[model samples]
Target: MFRNTKMRLGGVNILLLTIVISLIVLYRSTSYCLCKVSPVEEAFGQPMKSQPRPDSGEHRVTCHIPGLESRKQFYQYFTEKEYKCENLRWFGSRDGRKAVCMDMEFYLVPQDCHVLSFGINNEWSFDDKFGAMGCKVYSFDPTMGKADHQRSQNVQFFRLGISNIKGQRKVGMGSRFDFFEVDRYVNILERLGLTNTTIDYLKLDVELSELEFFQDVFRNTPHLLRNIKQIAVELHHGYHGKGLNKTEDITDDSSDMSPISTYQIFWQYFHELRCHGFKLFHARRNGRWTEAVWGNI
Candidate 1:
């Protein structure tokens, strides 16, 4: 009877050990299945979905201007702080030369208006549109081959380029042409008996000289642009960077000039205009370029 009891107890002990080992194996397998990470999770790694952008101050240590690192950020600042797009009326072609912004107030003006357009690359659609609206438009361009002045119904085309200069200066490598500075052009307008006249609309599309022209205007004749109702300009900064591509490139060869990037200089001039009470209203992107419209309102 003693031997039989011992044999039964031994069998029970072995059965209990087997059950415990099976439970431990099952537990380990389940734990491993839960811990195995998915391929998508492994690739994402950084948790971009859950985290905020570091530049937005959500993850930064200190606060400052966030949108200045890349082109995306630059435009974010342009649209948020610089551009004031409200109740705007887009006119002309969506992708043509006649494109412009005609605010409600300007669109309903009873009296005749005047336009000073710079850099006409053989496209007079904008000038023609304004002229049809009874606005006297003057187009200036030195690249028109001849200095012969041409006139339409209410629009006049002069082979004269606008800039900030003391007198007439010849431009171009060969077959040069004379270009007028801001003061000279204003004086010419005065001589033409348009004294105390306010330019209702100012349009500019100078290939790469727009920055220099702006600097000249601000440094010499800031008041020239003070009363302008609206200003539209196309910026060409897609080449090597922003600002005049040729100017920035040749700056390295010049001695009297500093090595400051043209992009930086452009921002400075642009801010100066803003400080003078010009608020951006529209921005149009054309591939690598951008056209911006500014108004006092």
Candidate 2:
């Protein structure tokens, strides 16, 4: 009897040791390697020989290149400044919404809030200059109140989230919402009768959990992810969403959000952005909510 009990305890210890080793191996294996930079990555770096900085003190490029990419140039310009958010200024802001500050890199305009925020968060406010460049903003918040959002001769707003994906249940305020949607943001653009539209810049702060919606739906629609000339993403972990439901192997790191740590989801998202012509020009200092910009910075 004594011998049998000892054997059982030893076996349990060995099995636990094996499980620990397996987890360690799995954790080390998922690290990602950066891909070859896109054409945008290449073009962003060449010396800006022809275009000079504007005298108005605002930095913006309106030139169109058939495959024009200048991410490297943007990198060199900002790297010289040590990737500090305060020193960089290419995007503009009119209201609080379009401020393009150290954290939120966007055009700010509080007066025309609905142009981007569909009145879901009364706390949501954009200064008078957000989306002034005619970027159509949508929200699917069912709690959105009815209001007349007038165009400033350029901007457009919608009272629903970009329900571009059709047939997905719109759960708002503990109820179901419905609308036949498209697979991409561009589809939402088309459904809203803006088929020939183009989004020059895009901001997605829809909670880090919405990555699965992006994976299942946004990715399918080529234009929404690819069309935007600029992006500002807020990375978060342990924010539950669709991808987690599908992948049981998903890691939860709420206790730690460091990139050098368990950063598989972060890696996958950034990898997708880089593949789609976004190359990091500038990112905030470590552990802060970074507002990194890619494209013709």
Report, for every candidate in turn, its global Cα lDDT versus the true structure.
0.59, 0.41
Candidate 1 residue 269 Cα shift, in angstroms, is: 1.9
Off by over 4 Å in 2: 1-87, 90-120, 123-127, 131-143, 151-154, 167-184, 193-196, 216-219, 240-263, 284-291
Best by lDDT: 1
- Model 1 score (lDDT): 0.59
Candidate 2 achieves a global lDDT of 0.41
RMSD of each candidate relative to the true structure: 23.7, 23.0
Q: Write the per-residue lDDT of candidate 2 for residues 107-188, one digit (tens) a residue.
A: 3334322233322344334412344534345533333454536434544444445332444434322122333222334345
TM-score of 2: 0.45
Q: Provide the lDDT at 65 for model 2.
A: 27
In terms of TM-score, which candidate is strongest?
1
